[model samples]
Target: MHRVKSDLLSAHIGSKPSKTWRAICDGIDVLKQGLIKRIGDGATTLIWACNWIPRTGIFRPIASKVPEPPVLVSELIDHTSMTWKAELVRNCFFDFDSDVILQIPLSMRKQEDFWAWHHETNGLFTVCSAYRMLVETKKNREDYFGSCGNCSDVQRIQKEWKHLWRMKMPSKIKVFCWRLAHNSLPTGSVLKNKNLANTANCKICGAEEDTWIHSLLQCNISKCVWALMDEDLLDLLASLRFSDPKYWVSYICCNIPQADGIRILVTCWAIWYARRKAIHEGIFKSPFSIMIMINRLIEEFEFVQGIDFKEKDLYQEKSRTHNWIAPQNGLSKINTDAAIDRTGTKGVVAAVCRNDQGGFIAASAMVIPHITDPETLEAMACLEALAFAEDCGIRSFVVALDCLNVVKNIREMP
Candidate 1:
């Protein structure tokens, strides 16, 4: 978010070895290069320096041959009718740039100019789209776009993140994969490096240093667990590069079967859990027993969460029939809605208040930056509705919400 950038982007990353801090700062730089201004009122965008024109690869118009002072995008607009000044636009820039500018549709509502990701048609920025833009640009690494060093390594890392998150596994296991990729797991060597442990050997095996690979895949317990897993899964793991945990994840996403992937991930999680339990509680379960428990856990989780296709469709059909109803007599109702842009990490929320007879009393809408989730936006909408009601001098009012979780929390609040 631009607001977030204002706060942290300027902080000096002094001689420090912090992955999280460096990531935040680097991400801010990426955001700056990726974001383009959407043409709205165009009052805030500069003509020569800003990236507003999406169709023109560079997102900027060529400079007029005749020297001119700084120009705002608003200057070219025919403000009285809320349209572009066609003749002026043609005269000011080259035909290529002029055509693209003319093709851009003007908003009748006269919305303010705002930043959006040009890579996405919907004006929302996503990591996937950004990654594609970076990797697809084969030339001009330092000039126009794209990253350095062939971009294959960059592509592989991004692919790993995407595949790990996309796999049908529990979120905890996915987070574990993230930790594994970052090498953040508290392996014996990692602990000793931080002076948290006196020795670097595994607490369970004690035969090798507790590096991620040694503790996760090569230790006696890990080897036993892997041995108990399906033969096909073990073979798939062996076929891929095991030099790095991240490489294994990327290859699995690309080459392995979905069911096999889930099985492998869940088994790895179980192995890690057993190791922790062995160190803390001094309880070590047999590899055969652990494999059985892992299978049961996987089956139970799938059975509980996987909805039937026909039933899901029928439920959706039933939900579609629930229409809006008028509030009780002498009471006002406030209906609130929100559109979330998960990629952009922001959203817009709007609320409409009406009388019992469906007569519109008031309405309010605003762009909310740095908001990523539905529940938080819906909760904020409810807050806004209450404020709107108070301002309208309406005390007996019912707030209608679309989020069931927020409603339940409100009902259960003491």
Candidate 2:
């Protein structure tokens, strides 16, 4: 080990004056900058060369045009006590670098300088950090995404993520929009790329890749849906020409009025939904029917927004009779339900368990890929509730189900 270390230091760090070893020397020089000093006695670390700041990484402060002799970390600290020499630091560093250096508190006593990996938060060396350092140096770029030239637009798109959430829609719809913007929608092409599908063809038309543009705008089905809307709306959507979904969506959302933009978003989401129905459930709705549904939902939401919900709640309070019954002491009750598609090929089973006094406990939800029978779905929900209760270490729990036949079947079980 000693011989190996000697060979490496002599060949790279120290002088091995040969043209063949030039590349190795250059590599070692680049590697040295990635090493950060932990700031102890400050004797070994050079003030300008070493990276010591926790927040700023390895930023060198330039106070002079001509470089001077290297200053050691120890020279910046007062030897009488473990405190920074503010005057020396000010002379050597700019205000910001001096502030960062001074912010690093010294140890109770002087100790040996310790080196750490600057790229990682935990100060541990990792291959990932080494690869990143190499890539950054080779590319000679400081942008967040070093390799991609068009990353500036991507960064801009990220800023508008909040716009999707701001829309007056369900949380699920917002997530759908977010996924669409990211081009992460599990269309046929995406599924094929993931090896989950045999081909990248459109599930509805089986022509070309099921890209975001084709699935949402260019497909015959989508075109038919757009034809049902007003000519002005169709023109507005047609005017979008961006190949990237995020850029396209951002352009429309920012340029068009919010009301009209929301309608477009709703239509896009509905188109994706109809495609999913056709793919997973073998159920297809006509483009005209999909448009009607979208308009109905928008009108309903707008109408409900204008109504006095407080008065409706008051009326409900006066007429309400059905109420949840609490379980007995030392026992828990679980309510389970499944929301299944019309064709029964896909559904989500959810279970929520609560204590006797209705205090929240544990809950679980599972997405079933396929369940032919609705009754089987109810059974799966019951089983999911039991499994969740067991996982929570709840021994005594009553399983509640809305289906009476399911409840009777459970009671009749041995």
Candidate 3:
């Protein structure tokens, strides 16, 4: 399958091929569009046609006349110097294009040219990435060809994009809010719209439709939470008069105080959380309880972001920097840390025990093949540190970790 040429993607289609083979060939055609060259030796890639240049995506010829034979990517680079032949590149391509061509890094190991699936991180084709691309393509087509009446919805959502993304909150929370704004959230109304649910009525209240607006704004629980807000905020919220949750959120975020706007978002999420608990566990939390939960969460987030305390206050208090500190004279200080790649496919855990004089007594590093949660990785590091200390015959050592949650868990242990 890896040996199949991209140019023959269409030639094999509908040629009495097996269903699986046909599917594979069709998939190859899709990947070909996103296929890019990771310039190694650059010997096999065509200069003008290959998507090798990082910025331009694909190389384009500047001259009106075409070359008799296609220019190879290797022709632009001088193998002796291991750099671009600047004069040759300038003559063949435009200034900007030439600059982009020059920026392509030469391989350190001088490996052979390889095709990169630009959509994926590992430079390989994936069904999920291809499906996402197709979904985006279909959405673009609908946006261009669909009715003019729905354009207003798209426009309104576009205006809210900045407000949703720029808010000082976690990425997951922002994404959840964005989904809510688009009515793409997995609420009962959305599920019903998708024919996945029997009814759109709120499972908890049963009085109104479980739409984003009703769930987050008009529901009795949501109303009680909103009522807890300051009168000025309540007045501003009422004056907006927008029934759409997305517009309501956007307006409030734009007009109200930033902290209050974040609090409102937190409250909405809290209401959703309560509904989730009611659905999953049959244990419903009251509006006041949910409000308290939201406040606690906001307070925690504020403390993490350093918004709750001034620099002077932080300076006055004993701050624990994420570094190793010596224990008392006879005691040992064990410091543990873990590093996980962005993909979360692999993790590395390391721990070291040092004496009060700052001399490392013992150290151990382990490569974890697979680990998902970063907190879990930190916990693993701590556990390994403890084991290392025990094996080294150390007693009553001080353990230190940058992860406060892990430290809290340790403190709460029996």
Q: lDDT tens digits, residues 80-156, model 2?
A: 86667877776767775666666564553547888777766445667788887787555545443455554433324
Q: What lDDT does candidate 2 reach at residue 349? A: 79
Q: Could you give candidate 3's per-residue lDDT for residues 1-414 as a string of tens digits?
A: 334455654456654677777778777778766777787777998766666764322334444232553378887767875666767776667675665566555532457897776665445677888887677557766866875244434434554688668777878678777777667867788888899989988887896478887787788878988898778667766677776666776775665666767777777788888888888799988878887887788878887775552123221325557455678888889888888766755677899888989997889998664353567678778877877887899997988888887777666544
The global C-alpha lDDT for each of the candidates, from Candidate 1 onward, is 0.74, 0.72, 0.71
* Candidate 3 TM-score, true structure as reference: 0.40
- The most accurate candidate by lDDT is 1
Ranking by lDDT: 1, 2, 3
**Candidate 1 backbone collisions, by pair:** none
lDDT of 3: 0.71
The C-alpha local distance difference test score for the whole of candidate 1 amounts to: 0.74
Root-mean-square deviation of every model: 13.9, 19.4, 14.0
Candidate 1 on 1-414: residue-level lDDT in tens?
213334443455557637876787778777766778887889999998888886524778866844673399888877786668878887888887776677565554557998877776556677998787776553545534433443334435555688778766778988987887667889998898999989998888686688888877889999999998768667777776576666666666556556666677788888999999899999998899889889887786668756232132221224447666999999989999877664754677789999999999999886665454567578768877877787789899999988997887677554
Q: Which is the winner by TM-score between candidate 1 and candidate 3?
A: 1
